[model samples]
Target: MKTYPVKGSVKLADGKPLASGVVVFAAPEMGMEFSSPLGDDGSFVLRSSYGDGAPEGTYKVRIERDPSKADSQARGGRKSAAPAPYPAKYGDESSSGLTAAVKPADNALDPFVLVK
Candidate 1:
């Protein structure tokens, strides 16, 4: 299937970058999903098994904690049980109410601002 470049950033309601996490794009209707890890600046570029982009479709978006970062924090004796960077609701696509549309061209999504 053809795919298009999709990129976006995540930030808190306070305007601070999320720093670390994973951004998920789910299109159940198409049985397609794409994800990318957030950069230190909270930027992300979606990629799927097919390539470095997502197929054209509307997707429900979700944000999740990056397991690698969590593991590192645990090894450092930090509280790995700390709350997610964003609200728990944002972690579930069903409840996140976040969506993105990928067109035939490049997609540069608006920043997803999360609230507590």
Candidate 2:
């Protein structure tokens, strides 16, 4: 299986970085999937479980906010008040409206912008 480095940034509707989250890429046809944690600036570099980059294919992209990280940053570390920053719709592959095509030679993906 070939691998290619895939990196990109995510931004909120207001044009600010997403801060922290997880970005998932699923290529069901190829039985390949990968995910990466978002940086403080909402940047991510996709890496597979085998420590290799993702294989070439089109992927369904999903972005989910990390609740544990959110809770700790929620002023008092309270879990209840730590609502997700992005809408629930964007957390699933079916509704995220995000996708990517990893070419055999290219290494980086374009930035993703999430809007409310």
lDDT of 2 by residue, 1-116 (tens): 66888888888888888888899998878776799999998899888766556887888999987877877776654565655666778898889899998887656777888888
lDDT minimum window of 10 residues, candidate 1? 71-80
Instruction: Point out where model 2 deviates above 4 Å.
Output: none
Q: List per-prediction Cα lDDT, in the order shown.
A: 0.90, 0.82
The collision pairs in model 2 are none
The digit string of per-residue lDDT tens for model 1 on 44-77 reads 9988788878988889999999888887877567
What is the Å distance of residue 53 in model 1 from its true position? 1.1
- Per-residue lDDT value at 44 in model 1: 97
- Against the true structure, what is each candidate's TM-score? 0.92, 0.88
Model 2, poorest ten-residue lDDT window?
A: 74-83
Alpha carbon deviation, residue 3, candidate 2 (Å): 1.1
Look at candidate 2 and tell me the lDDT of residue 84. 68
Q: Report model 1's TM-score to 2 decimal places.
A: 0.92
